[model samples]
Target: MVSSAGFPDFTRVVSKTIHAVVNVKNFSKKYSNQFDPFDFFFGFPDDFGNNRERKPQRNDIPGLHGSGVILSPDGYIVTNNHVIKDAEKIEITLNDQRTYKAKLIGTDPSTDIALLKINEKNLPFIYFSDSNKVQVGEWVLAIGNPFDLNSTVTAGIISAKNRSLGILRGETQSSIESFFQTDAAVNPGNSGGALINTNGELIGINTAISSASGNFIGYSFAAPSNLVAKVIQDIKKYGTVQRAYLGVKGIDLSKTEYLKVYNQETHQNIKSQQGFLIGEVFEKSGADDAGLKKGDIIKSIDGKPIQNIADLSFIVGTKHPGDKIRVIIIRNKQKKIFNVILKDLQGRKKIRTKEEITPSELLGAVFDPLSKESKKDLGIDYGIKIKEIRTGRLSAIGLEEGDIILSINGIKMKNPNDVNKVLKKYSGDVTIKSIKENGQVYIAGFEMN
Candidate 1:
């Protein structure tokens, strides 16, 4: 409902979605700071690990009072990954004030969506709207528990779409950042709220805001319901996201960037420079097999025009490995179309379900082969550095971020991919030879129970 001045009347929409929205509280006991204040300032031996559950010296405890949306009538809910991350306890408060301890079903940190389950049944839920059909300037109502106040509704229009804010890029190697931009007043407690349309359908999940004061300052972002819908299904099925990869490194281009390129080059004449420019193609990649090459410009995919990297990510992130997509690109000033099959980060054309794999088989560490310079410096010819420790069962078992893996079960690791291949085929007890940054070497052992 809209008035003459364009401000929407969100009466019925609020009534439909308010019950579905929940207030999520993530409680945490005080933890000793991981780094010693004096040591951190003076560069000495520090408290390297966070010892949580210790009695606090003061009363400053961390708490997360966020929001969530019920996705089904049987107590399934959706929220942001950061909301419940590392939470010792998750307490969900319904509209009727009934509280339940939420069970973490799964989480995709790249997309920032988490699925939670409660024992309650016959709960009110909201259906997802076709976010691709959502247009700019369409009226939207954000319903949540802002500032810990329940059932708050604010009306605004969809300010933009396919917004790439670069918030999720550092979270993973394959982060998706296509967000729906809106002007709704969102604050600290609105992290996982519902963004609904005029018909009261959930179009997006209010996740972030572009603000300097840590509060809503007219600009906010949400995970589109279309991507959310796909991720939720993957989480429920595979216990993780089946992120498909096109396997091409590229640069998003504009006319301004095209002009800069044209001025720098002393070669043949170039034109039509408003698309993604493929800079490199990895070996044994989907792009390589699809006949894509460097210097090619991707124009569209599956009849949809791609404006930038965010658009490309949104298109590919919704798909599974082995799914074929038609890619259109311009090569040598000529338009060409090729059918390309997507693959996962493991270079597998097929994704193995969670039930078919053990928790230890899933190595959650991103790795980089030790460089020649590094190998020469360290006096080691076979090793890989743990670049980032992603969330998994392995990470929980004391795997620090900077640990360099040398071997597993006496099999020397030569590169980043060597460990995964070893883990994929091996079974039973898991043992790893690793070296710390302080030149201390140790063996980490665990089982597949």
Candidate 2:
């Protein structure tokens, strides 16, 4: 007799989710043609000449295989960015061994979500759940193809949320992190898979795991479906994800104890407390244009208390460019309200395309204007010497303070404006050739996100 005093049965839910999961196999081929004198003289088994009665054997190149969930019945699927990154070919195999070639629609490296399309109709798909309502310790399932071991499913509860592992992708780092942490056994081949609730609704996308030997070590992270949905919608409509930016630069409030000495030295009477303190404001930026000055403490955004840098980032990220909102700040022990119009980090009213790189957008190292003294010290005629590395794209790439940028992609950069112009013309990877004071040349590559 079957026992009736058990928890709710979830077998049917797992069965339905399994039908929507598919195994992705990426294929590639490499051919080598070279003349070997020793082999020709010794009578080799295979001939290298084109006229010979032999053909090159087909080489199977196994790429980073993973899993994907069918998002729609018309064959729209969702997967991870790391799974199909740099893949020359993508093949999707169903549970029935039926396979088809998939086309890449879009990818967001910051959240590690990718959209793929295939030519099919009426396919089984899964629905997304309200990830915001999912509580920690709730039952969830991680479905994927681990180690090529077809369609494996592991069950666990949510461990934590809003995790920052410092995983970066090129020049774009995810400032909005509300990850659903779980102890699911996610592995290499399971990168682009689904994390679902007991109701079979997709809540998160399995992305990474914390392991020492490349195996599961009781820690895994997933991109929340809320963030995933936004990135997918943006990529599908505009071919890229657009992010809203706050104009002020500030350190995390939790580290105020260690920064008291520096803060006191910079501004007298400005107490180092728990909140985002404005360090520097860009000229004519959204915050600057709204009369926000340095040394002001950001108390909250739209009535929500500002906790740290990430908290402010998350609140700002939810808004779009040109959206107006009220910001509460504490300046000199006085509470003041300011109405600020949000803008993209570049102080632009809208998101820019591939051909727009302004001086403010080139956030990285600060360059000193061309002067006779600077030119004599750096031994460069038509280049700007790096003065201070503030905050921006270059600082994330390990650009030091004394590194002098001679040219960008072979175009001589005379000043910061010239460097921005050269960078704006190119859309993909841009190379920077820098020279040190002691004459050591190093190459750095920057990719636009």
Candidate 3:
């Protein structure tokens, strides 16, 4: 498809895919008290000069603008979670300039993908391509809105695969970072946009750019479509991602310096220059059940070569609990193959529904919104009561029954649902402000990761 001048013609791909890319706007919940031009130009209220905070109505201005891809004809849209994160309202504008309010269906912070639904029907959508077949140097197109420019299209080639830049650290500690690296000119407003191949098939979702000056520096990353599809399907079916865990902590052998230190500390010379070296295998984990152990080097999965942690993570991430994989590893310089079954976070082999995986169930506790009488007694307007504590994170952290949860990581817990929302999306640096059963204030901090 390369033209005479050596440029692959992008006309056909852009024409079909551009229409499915929509503009996403995140509206702020409250307006700032900063000097308002309207108030400055007109007569102010008598209390304008008072040193008090006023809860203003919703702001009309969008706090952030990004691009999203329409994934289904019946109004399913997909975009980066950060694009609409914390927004009081989400607005979607189609290519025809028809705007509609979008409802957030679900979000998977680990993948940075969110599912949205609008009321309209019979819309254009993009089809998912086999991202596993996407190769380096393949021609591709980046379609999105950048700096308010609608339906902008850019051309590039896949520069690399299975790249992990740790750009998703803010999303979650268990973040999946395997991405397709490209030089596709993605910019500020391109997050949640489409990264399609020359055949007009969606290969990835453009998520982040690696740059120091906040502009494209010939490096952009996308969450591969294979993983995106799995996440979307889970969200649609279960209202949350059915994340599977391999539960093995290890070091990538490709990093020579770290490998050398590991070799010295472990008192062994691991000469292999590539693959992931297992440092610890959690008990009762899939890897442990499959007979995988410490000091083993993972060489492949289902015959695909494992070059680093990214490769291993990506292959495992695309699968759900109860899925089986063929894993090959090197143990004592001898190759060994094992059939491994993945497990969910609760170390179960069955898929869990939203109710089964609730924050209360995961934390081994029961929560309820603070009673009116309790709120009046504590002189607090918001708190979630831990009605009972079982063997979960709360109990492990010393929180007991009748404890009141005021906040986590600075976010107020107004109800049990608020606690679920925060815990579902966040990991690492857990700080909980609560009240003990004795009416004394209590706070607990720990590293969840």
lDDT (10s digit) by residue, model 3, range 279-336: 9999999999999999899999999999988998899998899999999999887999
lDDT of each: 0.77, 0.70, 0.81
- Of 2 and 3, the candidate ahead on TM-score is 3
Clashing residue pairs in candidate 2 (N, C-alpha, C atoms within 3 angstroms) = 363-392, 363-393
Residue 29 of model 3, lDDT score? 45
- Cα RMSD (Å) per model? 8.3, 13.1, 10.7
Cα error, residue 63 of model 1, in Å, equals 1.5
**Top-lDDT candidate index:** 3
The residue-by-residue lDDT of candidate 1 on 52-102, one tens digit each, is 232323212436678999999999899987777545457899999999987
TM-score of each: 0.76, 0.66, 0.78
Model 2, range 1-449, lDDT digits (tens) per residue?
11277665667888888988888876544221333221221133334443223344322366458899898999888897656654546789876778998876666555567788888998989998877688988888899998888789998889976565545333244445557799877877777788999889999988777764557878788888877777777656654556666787866666666467656677654555657888888787788889999878898888877766655765676666787778999888899999998887556677665344354344445676667786786677877667865334444333556777888878888877777677654455566777755556655554543
